[model samples]
Target: MIFESSHCPEDSRVETQFCQNLVAQANVDRAITPERSTSISPDSIRPKPSQAIQQIILFTPSRASNPQIQAALVKLQNQVAAELRSRGFTVQSVPTGLDSASAIAWINRRATPNTFALSLQTDAFLNPDARGTAAFFRAGDPQRQQQAEELVKRILRNVPTLVDRGARPDTETAFGRLPFVRQLSVPAIVLSVGFSTSPQDRNILLTRSSAIAQGIANGLAPRPVQARSTTQVPIRIRLNGELSENQGFILGGNAYLPIALLNGLAINFQRPKTAQLFT
Candidate 1:
């Protein structure tokens, strides 16, 4: 998210400390999980776990005209790749200085159905006031749209100061089509972190680099979703004809509202001592 400021701010000690804390937390969350019991019965056999789909291909625009912007993009790309590697992702970064066609070809040669690709670039405009975070996906593709939304959402969560330009189709881009989003065999997204022309945005890109990288890493490789029961399916909830942010679930042909939602509505309910409610 990008916001306007009067001057380009220097990286303060406070910002450095904050970034360190965020990166540390991200590492802990991604690296640690609960351990299963080690003791096993003699007759029991352990099944081999399926291989994880954690491959990622990351790259940045090789032809950025501005030398300063190009250098910053490379730095941000390396920061994101390092963060993802710390989170146990197998990240392959396309070499810098490759032209667009060659970069796309390199990714295509390595991409598979299980691979996810992300191209990072800072936006620029004649109008310096135009500054914000935006992501582009293949036009009319739901999966790409979902991935783009998640990417923007994660970034905003990490840095709320920037305006959310929202997820857009590649057709809406100035170029009308981004090969990185359209030509790759795997799911792909093109992220515009912020407008390099805007001083405020440049300050953010400089000071909040780690947070931005962590946000990108989080979006690209989100935590694994827990298995759901077959009897349960997600359902949207509505209140007074307005959609509620909190979702409920349909279980055994019945719609169940979450306790948190009921509490928000000021509804009073008593729980039995033996009852367990999961939100």
Candidate 2:
């Protein structure tokens, strides 16, 4: 965010030139930044349950060398992808014995407006003593960034025993951005499920793999609307924080919305030419 209070010229004279110079300097600084990434807005294609989410890519990125590491990573990847598929998600994984880059490349080439990617990794780079989960998302694209954070929160709920490291900014200046997340063409989240070197963290991965995968699935899944019961509470409705006449007082709490809003319901009136109507 630009701070106009500090930077704006006190005198209005030659303000345009001052503003132009500031913009030029900002552009130059941006050019020198190595972490810069191209961004796209997905306004037309935010994933919806029936139409938006067509394919999900489950990827474990490293090209492991050790025999044990390679076999174990592949098994984890397969099982997680399997769990997502079982939840009725269309999931694709790197076929047995193939390099991760190939699978990632395939995903990039075939990425549709309606797909999302899940990049799974064991966070061994973090200190061995540090334990818990973290999720990462590229900067920009608020909807995509939010999806990443919400999924992280959902993962936390399922894996309650583990410490919550929370979500990390992929574009933070201290840690240069993650390349895979930066380049991936779809909305993506990088999940560090646990630390491999930490024994307890390792145990969580070994024991709760399915539950974690299921949590991720639930985060992305279209929530089922509860059948409206006799119980109801009236509330003034707001859409995206703004209230409109189209939005009237409805039966629900702001903490959670009713199914009528989720799937959409309309109150309609039919009038005859001569009729004077009362609501």
Candidate 3:
């Protein structure tokens, strides 16, 4: 999120405090979960336990000393820290120089598994003083890396264009062209709060990470894969009833399977509902 201010000094302070609070939340969430145990019969085999999902939060701010931005940034950061700590996340907030290359380099230093970094401008989106700003994620199966990429791509396609005298100009100057780089492995979705000028209203832009999560759960999107030869295969589908030359077969892709008949020979191959590109 990019925040615009009249003076740089007025906004630098908010950014610094925001970074500090995120660091504190990261430390608190790292504490170990309490253990509990129950014994099974000696003859019974032990069951494998499910592991917790780990996520890291990274924040990048261009100017760190501005007073107006710093106050807002720090208060917002502290609120974020408290919320994330209540949930389970290791949040690391880092304040760095405005140079895009250097800020990215600073982020690289704190990289971890399932890390999500948020780079925002000072005072980008000012939420109402009462509501406070927040991005909510619906907890479910962890979203895969490929699904995240596709959603992110769709989001980039949707970014509002900035126009200058009928000519489009770059809106994000500090992080010029950084969003397109795809080297980072873990999927990241950015939630930004900023001002919108169509009707001169305050708006929140949700990058749809949760919607991506749902699409992935339903297996509507394909996972990322390496390049491979486009080999075609002949598919021979079988139906239960006998076929006659005079009887024309109508194929319908949308059908719900009966759960009770699944255990029988009525249904065999498990296939996704989406249309297949290859036949």
TM-score of 1: 0.61
In model 1, pairs of residues that clash are 1-162, 2-162, 2-163
Off-target runs (Cα >4 Å) in candidate 1 are: 1-53, 224-279
lDDT score at residue 249, model 1, on the 0-100 scale:
88
What are the TM-scores, per candidate, against the unseen true structure?
Answer: 0.61, 0.58, 0.33
**lDDT tens per residue, model 1, 1-279:** 111121121234564355445445534543472121122223322222213447888888763346776777788888998988887888899998787679878987886656778888876554678778988877767777887899999999999988898998765543335677666667778898998878888889888888998898888777667665557688998799999999988765667778888899898888889864655
| Least well predicted 10-residue stretch by lDDT in candidate 1 | 1-10
Higher-scoring candidate on TM-score, 2 or 3: 2
RMSD (CA, Å), each prediction: 20.5, 18.4, 19.5
lDDT of each: 0.71, 0.59, 0.34
The lDDT of model 1 is 0.71
| 149: Cα error in model 2, Å | 1.5
What is candidate 2's lDDT per residue for 1-279, written digit by digit as tens?
A: 011112222223465356546656545555796444343323223333323776888777553433444455556678767766776778877455445457656777877777788777665422357567777766655666677778777877888877686776555422234545656667777777766656777677777776777677766774578775534444567777976344333233323344355455463434459843222
Q: What lDDT tens digits, residue by residue, belong to model 3 across residues 68-116?
A: 4444444444455444544556766665444555555555566665465
User: Taking the candidates one at a time, how many backbone clashes does each contain?
Assistant: 3, 0, 15
Q: Sorted by lDDT, highest first, which candidate order results?
A: 1, 2, 3
